[model samples]
Target: MSIWQDQHVTVVVSGGIASYKAIYLVRQLMKQGATVRVTMTAHATEFVTPLTFQTLTQQPVFSDEFTMQDPKHVGHVALADWTDLMIMVPATANLIAKVANGIADDAATTTILATTAPKYVVPAMNSHMYANPATQRNLAQLQTDGLQVLTPATGMLAEGYVGRGRMPEPDEIVDWLTQTLIDQQTDLPLHGKKVLVTAGGTREMIDPVRYISNRSSGKMGYAMATVARELGAEVTLISTPTALTQPAGVQYIEVLSAAELLTQVTAKFATTDMLVMAAAVSDYRPVKAVDQKIKKQPGQTGLTLELTETADILKQLAAQKTGQFVIGFAAETQHLLANAEKKLAEKKLDMLVANDVSQPGVGFNGDTNQVTLLTPNSTPVTTNLLSKTEIAHSVLTAAINRGA
Candidate 1:
């Protein structure tokens, strides 16, 4: 959702057994929200057909400079101009040598020469071929030319021996690309800051099996974490068990009970710039938890368990906060604003989000949410029913506007 989203990525495929790996690379890029298009050398078709890549990207593959399908625009030049980022995968020795010396004979090399966008070169071939003096000189020249190049893996080759010059695994390549893109984006709003987010309903166990929790599905917290990440913050998501898939590029920590959640959040709070406490912490827990499951009495009509107050995580953490911007959530069935206002002032929170969970399509295990935003000495602002993602954006935008 950061650099890869809506990006115009051009993949240049050259000849090698590693050409097949490019397929997975394209798929991964698309998964990261990129608009991908592929260009291939004529020889690359022998290994992977153009139709394969065509079907994968749902865009025409460019392999020949001579083919003029569009009357108004030259093929390679148009592709070059359309590209925001270019990748050369399985860059064979022939292509590398040509690119090093500025030879533009085919569609792939011609587009590479014409495009002003950043180029990433991934070389794969025989170990001896990669070790040749000419190849070494060309590789160095590529670095000197300001292109990002990945060192090939030292592993088993198609020739059935272990050595260098194997293309890196597809997933590894995608990870490298993702990190590189994030590093390059210095102007992102939360670029250098750390954000801590807690999600889900904390469980307070009474026995081995029975526990106290809530209807919180962690959807709101997950959305907050994901949106914070998309805003370019180094996000840490501390969550209770849920069915949600963890967002990419964010650090994750797991906790089951309120005590564990408190420990993790407090441990990371010192370095955090902003904290969003979205998890529904249990108000009371069993006073004594037995190791084994509690059994029902033979003649008993009901069961009674002693309960005690759980730790006040938000109030404790916020009371000691120095420069950190702390945000807390309150779910009330009645007197939403009055109750929320009391807590907001008592906890000394920079922002408080209050919602009435009794409404439909709003809060607790649902994809949609409606909330009232409160800041110290300011009027409360209410939001219409919206998807959790939209609510997340609104909340973060308000925080940023308030200089959080």
Candidate 2:
């Protein structure tokens, strides 16, 4: 069977010079056995006609909501329900902002806003426009909402400039979308296996207005999820609230505190094949959480607050392990290897990722990480600075090798 067999995809083309590429993407999806429906904005019609897309997709292109010719079939709601995956190729800045803000002024946006399916956005715009703070913020917000964002690459643009902002080629986009729809158990070394990945930093509430959290932004954990999906594992990510995009083919359970994390993890541990605890969970929380914001006293020299230890998530998970692969992360300053090895044995983890937070650009919120993969039986495998995506693939490979 094809990768996209029994799958339905909605390709939404926005207004841009890159709109023409959407047709090729549709054809590629069709080749992979996916049923595709096309939706285009008014300005998108300037470059390509509805007839052109209709002939390619073999489905009517939805342009306007009011143009529904039939009274019995609600077109917008029907299309929304039909879509299993939504990919917006050539997503312009205006379109990005609209989707980010939940604007549903047109057929494409309306269906997108209404659909409960996963959305993948491939942005294509001018280099400067792509890098604008407002656009970046919108992209981050979209990611935070669990939308998959494929970053624009650097290359020659239609505007005669060379930098980042070129839309990826149609075939590449198709491959990504195809991979996105494929079951995680197909052709993966870890096929028929279960994987648990934790990401972001938990927030420990002190008052209604304040909380304690670490510097972690959850990039590493998200990366691991992405890679694990690519390798054919059913992944469940326990994430703290963050702006990072959820990987395609992952089931995410969001938690705010260490206690919540413990509850979720323990509940899912029974059937899990491997557990990767990548979150920077808070070690302590305020003993008494103030229901209201704590008001500062005028004459107070310093505010004294009592704290209590949060649930030891990893240690507890380790105690109840049922021969499932367990992994942990050690973000340390001094005695890097020693600490990592200690954690590996003490927590009964199958492996631990040790990296010094003090090092520049190698820890939290950054794209690059230098990690040492510590195992119980052999020398640790250290890696140079690598993009989170690359590092994630390596880590998943290591885990699969070890587990197998």
Candidate 3:
């Protein structure tokens, strides 16, 4: 759900007791990296002060058409021209009718009517008013006018009655709006594509008490999943256990071992348009797992166990791929380029992301990394130290540019 970077969002608050909730909504949008500007109706300011929103957004709040702070440009026109997205929160019945009928009576409706950006409406009012025929007809008109509207949720209302017409909570609103924006951007490269990503280091079982694993904290893979979602892909993240929160808006699968990861990826591979194998799969595992914890021997100095090769996920997926674009990761402490090139060819991957884990803040558990992108017959492109999200964007952009 974390897609809104550099997006210009303009929120219009209308009159209602729910007007105050727009405060949290604006904050949520800004937290997702959006540049938010707020506009309010005169009735709305009765419930919440314009100064509150101005302080939260650190920008001027536009409330009245007659009160112009900038003499050089019409306030509504300038704001309308700058907005990439527009939202009408706590949209009262009066606001809905005005917008549906193209009435520009107040600063809120005037700016909303002037803006060509996609409009998203969230209505809040008495349940009976919401159920009225006029309101329903106006809402349908909004749909016909190509504006997106969120149905008010059902629950206890401010008037102490249980019914629909309550505006959604701040988090819920952000989630809905984020996905609605993604769905509307059909021109996005991965808009309709299904992307399967594997993350974290797989644990190879040794016994009930212990296992073999790596230092991978799954940050890189999670970042990839997040970025893929941002790019408009229907992303499914098959991840090993890691101390990271699951990224919202992506299907997540949890697995502990290399074999489990393989099974999950295989099940989704047939439908996947792109596959990012970011997982650091363990190469070897104990040949036999002890059902119970093994006890120390009294005099034995050393214990020996047989190890077997883990399944080669990349090579296997590469072999079975029909039209899917496969991406593999090479994490090496030494000989980064040489080792990466070898894996790229051997795995028959469409693209390979290679990094030197021995370098500071460059791989595994870290939030940042510097990686080289290798493709067949192309000069390797390496990144400076950057956040994993930035790296993910770089990697996806590279793959897309290469025909992924």
Candidate 4:
């Protein structure tokens, strides 16, 4: 299940030009399966209507504490008690001052004061105001009062100059929130574990411009890294060149070629508790790689190049394994189970994830995957076609179970 599934989140919007961005944040939270509620300051209403937020969240927007439509309970108190997490987006200077000074003058501040849930503050204002001693002091006070504050992004502001004090992008805010929530769960399956994951297809250079590589997009491996981090593992993602963003809170290392990947994984293997070999390292490389681009001869029909086998990284790691739980992936075009079982036994893998690349939407650059998990003595587990993220969770879950 997703970390945000069925979670209760309350978003407090204060006055600022960045208040409009709060709508995107709320929608993202909802997309992650969070039940979101909005509480806005009167000044915030000037920038965006309460009805807009109400329509988005499908819940009543709280703007005034005095207006009680529900006779059974106080609005602020009720909402505060219901909230599991509270986020103050575009937290204006005035709002920060009020909260820091215990001034519950509006519906937003009152509920913020009443809620016992963890508070995350994202401040947005002019660069000058953000750098001011008073604003900095209030932010410090929020921290001292046990609130988590996300650093504001620095960029072009509404005041017409490029500087600090831009509210972080919605995706960044959501990522931080997800990591924070995951970090809070001490009982997470992979908590306190160190995991190393390799991703993408390694490139074998044949010339200055030509190279040999696979169709692996690194999506599955990246997904594994993300899920592992969310499960409370300290993750190291060693990847080849890919267009994917690095997962938050992960140690990232970029490398090229099979030799570089081997060097990286070997160096970190001793300290790693779990090793996931998801990279598609090239099996062969040209025996002689030319420094300059190779040119075709006039009227030539073909070119011949000698090839040599690359290092067997999985076999090497398996042989050196002590207490580490090593997992390997098999991307096969034929004899899926038979080949996977042979590789699993040959490499002495603790677990193996196998997928038939010949099937459509099942492998190579796609967002979805259908995998079969194999272990030494257990029945092979086959999963239905699911997103890479879901597949990642399943793979990790199986690993954790095996390790336990």
Instruction: Assess each prediction's global lDDT (C-alpha) against the native.
Output: 0.92, 0.87, 0.93, 0.95
Q: With candidate 2 superimposed using the best TM-score fit, by how many Å does residue 401's alpha carbon deviate from the native?
A: 1.3
Q: List candidate 2 stretches off by more than 4 Å.
A: 1-18, 21-176, 179-181
Best by lDDT: 4
TM-score of candidate 4 against the unseen true structure: 0.98
TM-score ranking of the models:
4, 3, 1, 2
Where model 3 places Cα greater than 4 Å from the true spot, the runs are 1-6, 15-21, 31-33, 71-74, 92-94, 97-105, 124-141, 152-171, 207-209, 293-305
Best by TM-score: 4
Query: At residue 6, what lDDT does model 2 achieve?
Result: 65
Task: For each candidate in turn, give its C-alpha RMSD to the true structure in angstroms.
Answer: 4.1, 15.2, 3.5, 1.1
The residue-by-residue lDDT of candidate 4 on 1-404, one tens digit each, is 67899999999999999999999999999998999999999999999999999999999999999999699999999999999999999899999999999999889999999999999999999999999999999999999999999989999999899988999999999999998998899998899999999999999999989899999999999999998998889999999999999888899999989999999999999999999999999999888899999998999999998999999999999999889999999999999999999999999999999999899999899999999999998899999999999999999999988872
* lDDT of residue 99 for candidate 2: 95
Displacement of residue 65 (Cα, Å) in model 2 is 37
Mind giving the per-residue lDDT tens digits that candidate 1 earns over 95-176?
9999999999998999999999988999999999999999999988998998899999999999999999999988778767
What TM-score should be assigned to candidate 3?
A: 0.84
> How would you encode candidate 2's per-residue C-alpha lDDT over 149-264 as one tens digit per residue?
99888999998979788999987786576566555336658777888999999999999889999999999999887677666778899999999766656899999999999999
